[model samples]
Target: MGQVGTKDRFELVGTPPDHQEAEFADAVREGLSASPRHVPARFLYDARGSELFEQICTLPEYYPTRAEREILEDRADEIAAAIDREPTLVEFGSGSAEKTRHVIEALIARHGHLRYAPIDISRAALEASADGLLADHPELEMVGVWGEYARGLLTLERVTDSPLLVLWLGSSIGNLTHTEALAFLRDVRERLAPQDRLLIGVDLVKDPAVLEAAYDDAQGVTAAFTLNLIARIARELGGDLRPEDFCYRSRWNPDEERIESHLEVVRAHTAHIPGAKLEVAFEVGDRIHTEYAHKYTPKSFAALAADAGFAVERNWTDGEARFRSCLLAPR
Candidate 1:
């Protein structure tokens, strides 16, 4: 990556350094202390965890990434044309911004110039993506926002003066529960300037076997990605949580219409966290619930947008209808 953007264009916002660490320690302590133990999925994306996830995206069992990419590649021109104004494309959780190049190119091709705002919690990933994108797109102007999605959205309000097209790709919205998603979208709706639109990718409900395999792949890449959290605990929290004592597993929770990931205890052990100043004991059969990916049908998702104070402007799906990207406008 070369020809970095100007200093004023790239700045780290949101949680401060000490506070971020404190929040991580606090979250780990509290989640472990709960009866049904769990860890937040955001913590799973440390540098190595991020790299492993890139590997997971390529796995054949993981259909969402491929399916979503196909949707964008096929309809990006149409998607870009749907915008009523020349809008800056803002992407939430824009890791690597790999698939996003389709949308970026489409916007520039239509409007002749483009501005991109990428928001990410991982500053390193955000910076790297920015460098690669800048080197390639001379017509592109980028203002990188480094932080959580909420703070990043707020940052966009301050940095941008043009209409906005927010990109929430990769079916990442599935990370939130139904209630949380509604609240999350409402928060975004409250922040929108006029002419702003949101394009969000979502995984569609399908066969339980397919959903389960996507999360728990045959090559064990997905397993390694999930277990990287335990590795993170040892590395970052200075915790004596032996990674070998746990194994990764996922299930299709039909009742929830989601895939639930867990790190099942392989052997009974006690873990001591000096950083968090906490200790926990686990039984062999006990599970530490880690994450889930909720699936939705196009109809249900459109209704979801409506409840969240937005109208689904248009919905684009892949040929198999395995995934969809919904363009929305604030009601």
Candidate 2:
């Protein structure tokens, strides 16, 4: 594999070819200028934001992570068995890859050796996790990609020769709107070979109160995470933002079957982002849309997979049925 940053055992592969700064600036400007001012959830993950999100995963109300992990632990053997012999595992948005160890161990037991490709936008997260994963799985070969999902998949086309099993776990796909999710899944299907497979995790529709509580946790960690976007703008884009002037709130939008998180301006304020060359004015009660987590039913998600040219081969769910992990193959 092509290596970028090689440590004792871990190897970083694939260069980041995108101009992230320019892209971020453009996205920020566009979102701010839109009729209903908003920000993309992807921008919420700088180093500190990523750390906060990791903490959020462990919060009592955040059941997605725990539910997904339970399914992986219970059905990892079945998941590994569905893949081809000596398959290469590629994971998208693999933050720390904590839940992936179950699958890795199961694959290793069946094949004796394995190849893993973990892609993430955060170089720090990739580098930090690579060493520990390498130490734990001595019979594994790892390649780390520091980029977003689509770019990393393009790079994987060149690096992996074995049958591919692409993973998009933790219900992170819920962040995308239905249309965007279909488009993205189609892109992924196009990138995969005929024999390639995909294992995706998705959160299921549940009680509105439960959904809302997950995003607005008791410890205020979720609030801190939502407000970190303002801090990031101030630090990276030279924006004048007072984070304390805003409050984070989350509500269940039953009409859309999604949870929406917003940063509500507590008072009138103007924030200027020098990097984007834009200024945004907010009045009291004004809210900027920050994130959306869409919940799906099993039939709805299966239809989505079919639309993307994949046939759902097998699906495993947690005991509570609050989450599901579906294995799919090209139709």
Candidate 3:
């Protein structure tokens, strides 16, 4: 087996607890039991949770997946041609990596041999995706990193001599604050060689109604998905949480150019957390802010890439222009 790099040890950064599972459960109880209800979506992806998300993407209500696929299908050849050399493909938050298969296949067809490094939060998901990729493309070498997205990116090393084409797909970039996004991109830039390229997907600014529907899907799947975080905490940490007490709500914060997910407390309450050894109280109508999905315009997006030391090479958009995939080159 090849040696793993010093910085590539993902366990140290995204420490998911086996021993502290009970404590985490208590944290969940305290969080939900608080006046304003909130739980982070990052915790929603356990083995089963990740499988649920993959199903969510396939649902008709999800536009990001379909739109991204259309753009990739329409432009994979163009994207393939743009790369001057066959490079290792590095993906951040590589979930099922369904769309990535197209790009990876395209690169291998043109380049003959390519290395793949898929960084993800779930070790199970990483191994599953890597195993599938290896079975399909025996020529492609894969190095899987199980780590938090932002932390892992900061710690990634250039292990392969092949030039890199890094991917931050699924508009997962939107999950961060604007400042965090900028700094994260800048970190990516600092890690690359001058000629390396990046292909980023950004959900464009759109109707508030559309944005709201996507997050708060009519089928109630999104709501269930949000509530699962609380359940996960309860199960893992030994906290008593009534999932019905909190409602999943999403609203467009236009001024901030983001969609905010909040878990709202329906009534005043108090709860005891056995694991954390704390008592928490909640006031009626208090809400815990969960996540923010920021939309971006092409101009602002280009400026962000530029600041990150990348020049926008080409832009591809869905027919309705609801989303865009921009190819960028390191400056």
Candidate 4:
């Protein structure tokens, strides 16, 4: 955390005292010990995984990024006007904060200056992005929170009295199941004042073929992204696993209204992680569920907002309706 001159400022917010390595080991052990083993999608975001995801966004099949960016580009001014005067902009999972530039510029134009708070689990990404943003926008002041959504929100001390605008863009909410999403939204609602606004990006239900292709791109960047989780466990937790032992698979689950990503064991294998003191045996065809991307229709999302104590104020979408950015206020 440092300040440059009078214009640029940055602060790194620390997480709770829990050691990250111990937490990762515990999560891995608990996840693998369960029947129908699964890992939380959040673990898929190590440094390498983050880089691969940036590549995934540029792929032609991945429509969410482009569609969401389109809406932000077209409607940032309107979004800023809705929030009105100087407001502290808070973004969740603000990786690289590339799409954030539009909204930041719009806010700066409407008001005289901008105060931005970006919450992210990766300290490296947060610091790097914050530096670049600070260098670029002299009118901006930023505090980078190094924690997950709920924890970050709890740690976020109010920086400005000008109303709060929380941005959860890139459809990352799709990572949570319906019930989990509701609970998470409720937690967020509890943290906000009644007048505070939330603008969230959500991927829309579309052709199953399109969804499937997006997850399993021809270039195999998404595949590498999924496998990187295993590599991460091995690198960080003393797990003995080779990338060749498993294959990547993505499927459109119409019944679930989501796309599922899995790492299927191609051959019988045993993974031994000395760090966690755990051994896991996998037979051929045994799959580790890695991620889920849930797609929502407008009606479904509106109902979801209501259940979480938020009233949908407005929703902007791309021409193809592949994605949506909805504005909501606590009911």
Q: By TM-score, highest first, what's the ranking?
A: 4, 1, 2, 3
Structural similarity to truth (TM-score) of each candidate = 0.95, 0.95, 0.87, 0.97
| Residue range 159-185, candidate 3, lDDT tens digits | 657688888888888988878888988
Better of 3 and 4 by lDDT: 4
Clashes by residue pair, model 4: none
**Per-candidate count of clashing residue pairs (backbone under 3 Å):** 0, 0, 2, 0
Off by over 4 Å in 1: 1-14
Residue 190 in model 1: shift from native, Å? Answer: 0.6
For model 3 the local lDDT of residue 235 reads: 66
Task: Summing lDDT over every window of 10 consecutive residues in candidate 3, give the lowest-scoring window.
Answer: 1-10
Sort the candidates on lDDT, descending order.
Answer: 4, 2, 1, 3
lDDT of 4 by residue, 185-235 (tens): 999999898779999999999899999999999999999999998898899
> What is the C-alpha lDDT profile of model 1 across 1-331, one tens digit per residue?
3454544344445556677678779989999999789888888887888889889999999998899999999999999998867888889989889999999999999988888888887777877887777777778878777777888877666454678899999988999889889999999999886588999999999999988888988899989988988888888889689889999988888899988899999999899998788999999989988888999988789889999889988889899989999999988
Best of the candidates, lDDT: 4
Candidate 2 C-alpha lDDT tens digits along 137-231: 77877888887888887776555467988899989889999999999999999888888899999999998888888989999999999899888
* Model 1, residue 40: C-alpha shift (Å): 1.1
Best by TM-score: 4
Instruction: Evaluate model 3: give its lDDT.
Output: 0.76
Clashing pairs in 1: none
State which candidate, 1 or 3, has the greater lDDT: 1
